[model samples]
Target: MIGVLTSSMAIVSAGGLLFALGEPFIYQVTVMPFIALAIGVDDVYVMLGAWQDTRRTLAPEKRMALALEEAG
Candidate 1:
C-alpha cells in the first residue's frame, strides 16, 4: 500500500542520512526498518477496516473523521 511504502521510504531515508553522517549500518539498523514497515501496514489495515464499518448515511468527510477516530 502507499502508506506502507511511504513510511518505509522515510525510515530508509533517515537511516541513509545517518549513514551519510558516518553511522554504521549495523544488524539492528537493518531490522528496524522492517519492524516499522510491519507496524505501518498493520495500521493501514486497521484504518481500512474502520472505514468499512463507518455509517454510509454520514457525509464523506464525517465518515473519514470517524474512521480516523476509531483507528486511533
Candidate 2:
C-alpha cells in the first residue's frame, strides 16, 4: 500500500509535468499511452496487494473455499 501510494503520487506528478510542458496537444496525445501503461501496472499492484493481504488472512488451502463462498 505504501509503495502503491508513492508510485501513484509519482505517476501523477510525471503526468502533470507532461501536461504543463506545453508540448503540442497532438504530439502530447502520444504520452497518454505511457501514462495509461503506468496506471495499468499500478492497478495490478493494488490487486496483488489485495491478493497478498487475503492470502495472509486465510490458509492457502482455504483460499479456494473462500473464493467459492464469496462467489455465491
Candidate 3:
C-alpha cells in the first residue's frame, strides 16, 4: 500500500511537472496513476493469498520463497 501510494504520487508529480514545462498532456497520462494503483493492490492481494497457502511446517525463509515464487 505504501509502495503503491508513493509510486502513484511520483507519477502524478512528474506528470504535473511535465505539464508545467509546456508538454502536452494526454488522457492516458492522467489515468495511468490509477491503473498503477489498481495493479499494485492486485499484486498485494495475490502475495498475501500465496503466503497464506504456504506450508506452516516450512522454515520462515523457505515459506517466504515459496510464496513469492507462487505469487510472482
Candidate 4:
C-alpha cells in the first residue's frame, strides 16, 4: 500500500540521515519519536483504507436491498 511504502521511505531516510555525517546525539534521540509518529500515521491510513474498502463493498448491495424493499 502507499502508506507502507511511505513509511518505509521515511525509515530509510531517517537511517540515511543518521549515517550521513555531522549527526548529533539529539538527532538520535529524535528517531524514536519520529518512528512512533510514522507508525501511528501508517495505522491511521491503513484503517481509513480498510474503512473505505468496506464501505465500497457494502454500499451498492445496501442500496439495492433498499430499492428492492421499496419496490415490494
Candidate 5:
C-alpha cells in the first residue's frame, strides 16, 4: 500500500516537472495511471503471496526479508 502510494506520487511529481519543463511524453498521459495501477497491483499480489509462503516460526523482520527476496 505504502509502496504503491509512494510510487504514484513520484510518477505524478515527475510528470508535473516534465510539464513545467515543456518536455513531451512519448505515450499518452492518460494511459500512464492505468499502467502504473496494473503494475502496482501485480507487485502487491506477488509480495503478499511471498509473505504467505514464508515460515511462520521466523521473526517478523526475517519473514519480511524472506518475502521480499522471494517476491523479487
Candidate 6:
C-alpha cells in the first residue's frame, strides 16, 4: 500500500542519511532498516485485517477505534 511504502521510504531515507553522516555502516545499521520495514509492512497488514474484521454496521469512527484496539 501507498502508506506502507511511503513510511518505509521515509524510514530508509532517514537511516541512510544518518549512516552517511559519520555513523558506522555496521551490519546492524545496514540491515535494521529493512527489518523495520518488514515489521512495519506486517503491522499494516494486521491493522488492515483488523479493520476489515470490524462490524460493518458500526460507524466509521467507532470501527476505526475498534480496529486500532484490535491491532494494538
Q: Which candidate gets the maximum TM-score versus the true structure?
A: 1
Q: Which ranges of candidate 3 are over 4 A from the true structure?
A: 9-23
- Relative to the unseen true structure, what is the C-alpha lDDT of residue 51 in candidate 5, on a scale of 0 to 100? 99
The segments of candidate 5 whose C-alpha lies over 4 angstroms from its true place after superposition are 1-4, 25-27
Could you give candidate 4's per-residue lDDT for residues 1-72 as a string of tens digits? 665577667777876887797665664575675675678576766555555444345676675565444433
The residue-by-residue lDDT of candidate 3 on 1-72, one tens digit each, is 765876778777888799799998687666778777888778888988999999999999999999999998
**Among all windows of ten consecutive residues in candidate 5, which has the lowest summed lDDT?**
25-34
Q: Which sequence of candidate numbers ranks them by TM-score, best first?
A: 1, 5, 6, 3, 2, 4
**Candidate 4 lDDT:** 0.62
Q: Which lDDT tens digits does candidate 6 get at residues 1-72?
A: 865686678887887788789776666566766777778888889989999999999999999999999999
Q: What is the C-alpha RMSD of each candidate to the true structure, in Å?
A: 1.4, 8.8, 2.9, 10.6, 2.1, 2.2
lDDT against the true structure, each candidate: 0.88, 0.62, 0.85, 0.62, 0.86, 0.84
- List, residue by residue over 27-71, the lDDT tens digit for candidate 2: 656576566667767766655555554565677767656554443
Cα error, residue 22 of model 6, in Å, equals 3.8
Per-prediction TM-score, please? 0.83, 0.42, 0.69, 0.38, 0.78, 0.74
Relative to the unseen true structure, what is the Cα RMSD of model 1? 1.4
**Model 1 per-residue lDDT tens digits across residues 1-72:** 877888889897898799899976678666887888888888889999999999999999999999999999
Which sections of candidate 1 miss by over 4 Å? none
